[model samples]
Target: MPDTSLPKTAADGDAGQGGGPVPRSTALVLLLLVILLWGVNWPVMKEVVGHMPPLTFAASRLLLGALSLLAFAAATRQLRVPHRGDLPLLLSVGFMQMTVFTLLVTVAVQHVPAGRAGILAYTTPLWVVPLALVFLGERVGWLKALGLLVGLAGVLVLFNPSAFDWAAPPVLLGNGLLMLAALIWAVNIVHVRAHRWIGTPLTLAPWQMGMAALLATAVALALEDVSRIDWSGHLVVLLVYNGPIATAFCFWAMVTVNRALPAITTSLAMLGVPVVGLVVSALWLGEPLTLTNLAGLGLIGAGLAAVALADTRRA
Candidate 1:
């Protein structure tokens, strides 16, 4: 998830926890890999929803991802039932971050280009500022406020009449849902910051994913016809890549990087995810990258960078 805490560094020696030594170079490499996987996942997911109903695809991936996480946890001897004290955090993250976020993005990508969808979804950091103020009663510093304004300006640029089609309800709905997904993810981040940890996030991850899998599966069953799916080799490859590589491996890599690098490094590095997503979408999916869209992406990236700087300063 969002690991905004300061880092454990033998290199930079930033103010953070003193954990076991991990080479800075190794951590950076892992961070880069995480970015690649998550960034490429946008286009991959777009392809996935094209092959089947969005919810059904979401359900399948979530189940596979949960199983992968479960296997990893068991192998590491970290598997356990949820602690009562951690239940709220687990449930909040499972539903908001895992299930709802996946569902929204899966559906939204149908109408929104994968590149634009990536930019919109990564607005989670921008939304986190206002959410933290309201939910966590955190004071908004000038940088955070400025970041919020700049980010909103970027969003406006994307939604302006010339950029987005006002007459198309599906387009509007898709963009709105993507924004909602970002907001929901921000809510989870806020909860994560507030909650006292009864179990480590890594330890609780399997349960969270499993819960998301079950909920998505139930919803997909009720709403979607599974028989309509036309399975093929491409779909199987995408599903396997999404579940094991993108979801499970990427999360593990991120957590590892978070523990090893400076919080600022991790946060700033993650901005690469959307950048890679946009580039890959353009190259792989041949999605048109209009000047207006690029301008919006630039503004959002700048805003997110400012927020990351502010967070590092605060930490």
Candidate 2:
């Protein structure tokens, strides 16, 4: 839940009268829309990366996303640099959340289908429970502990030797990178909890995105031949949808959702993202569905649900 102590203007929604909380009905709609934006982008990224080199694609998406964020910041007069002390926070959060995570997923998706990559990446939430226990000294209840175990089993399922081709370098690297992306994202989530806010987070977002874009571009230029990338109808669609709608606007929606709903409630509701990602990938990318993958997905979803339930009760 938002701090009740926040000013009414900060907490009120468009439909609210006298600066009150958003109606649950309105908040629910906003949550679903954000989830859809996140879920659908998986296939969009997969499709774009199919034709474009992964690093180049990653750099372009982050650059366009950075531009979109900067435009929003400028429009709202939030376009100043962060204080010098906050530079470290910028580096840590920006590196893990945007740069490293995006680059890994871009490469990872070249081998893993969009659906599998989405599931593996969303494991970020599952990884958070243990990190919280260790770093924040938060106690895990029996439910959360068991949920974590089930999640571990799901990871095992993904690497089932009978089905998975471990000898294939791309296959191995893809899964490994996805797991690394999840772990680093988990680290960033914990860091976010420990950060002391100096300004509205939205103000810092453009800078963080810019940092990611610059780093990705540097890497892409050093390793990739950019001249091979070509423009297309599909590429045009991908740039608009992924950069502006999915990355920029969805982030804005997330910030508002945080103020409008309970923290645990929001997390639980957003779990719909990976599920939608899996389905859309199958439909759009023609990613084959194996029984093993479905079983793994089910276990992961169950674990996340259990953890969310325990977290909700604890909160």
Candidate 3:
């Protein structure tokens, strides 16, 4: 669902670079849309996955999401392919961020509650700190180090041995996949932050999404029974919501909001996504909320804020 997260960048300013500033009221509204569409999608993703194979659902969303973004790109005259040297980075980022994350989370939600799955997936910022330190030559000061600790501690809380069934294969499988998904996205984010931009984020978005769609569809065909989907109006609505609204429009909103708001403000706002996911899942899907989950989410969100603020200072 588009990381269902905000990117850490005040450096890449192409989204609103020349458009002038957006009104605060308008920007705030758009930011809410970003959180609501993505946060709500966790439960929606869970429900739709119940009606169809996860891989099939993921594949369909990727295909449609790519198409929707492509349409936007065409209309905006931002459609273009990357340079030859950019291919590897583009493919690698696209595969991990778009395909791998989606595939892993698709499988994960089958075994874990969607609320929990969403929290695990959003732990991506935690991975970014270490990976960026190693690969991007980014420095981690004391604050970020504290952030890293707090974030990992939250992850540990979620993985509490007393509460989680270590003996259950589904539990291990689901948690492992979700964490891996976050790690994969974190790696991508580091690469994105490190890369010398040959194109704007919006310009690169559709191509990467299109490439990911092909890869996901290939995997879905190889491993999943596509015929399992119970086709109906409900399915189409979910597909549209998950595809265009959640993925493409969410990206659009991120670009706009990132431009309109301070980078740290945007990053901090993103931390609310998981809370919304948790609450929506509780109300809509009836997923039980536990003290541990609540505490873990709070710590992770705080940790993420620390990291985002640290990155802002670094930038």
Highest lDDT against the true fold, candidate:
1
Candidate 3's C-alpha runs over 4 A off are: 1-36, 251-271, 304-315
TM for candidate 3 is 0.80
Task: For candidate 2, give the lDDT of residue 99.
Answer: 89
The sequence of per-residue lDDT tens digits that candidate 1 reaches over residues 206-242 is 8888899999999999999977787999999999999
The parts of candidate 2 lying over 4 Å away from their true place are 1-35, 151-161, 250-272
Query: Using lDDT as the measure, what is the rank order of every candidate, best first?
Result: 1, 3, 2
Q: Residues 15-73, candidate 2, lDDT per residue (tens digit)?
A: 32123444556666777898888899899988888678899988888888889999988
The lDDT, on a scale of 0 to 1, for candidate 2 is 0.71
Candidates in order, TM-scores: namely 0.79, 0.80, 0.80
| Per-residue accuracy of model 3 over 27-106 as CA lDDT, tens digit each | 67888898888789899999999889999888888888889989988999988876554565567666887789888998
Tell me model 1's lDDT, rounded to 2 decimals.
Answer: 0.73
RMSD of each: 5.6, 5.6, 5.7
Q: Model 2 Cα RMSD, Å? A: 5.6
Local distance difference test, per candidate? 0.73, 0.71, 0.72
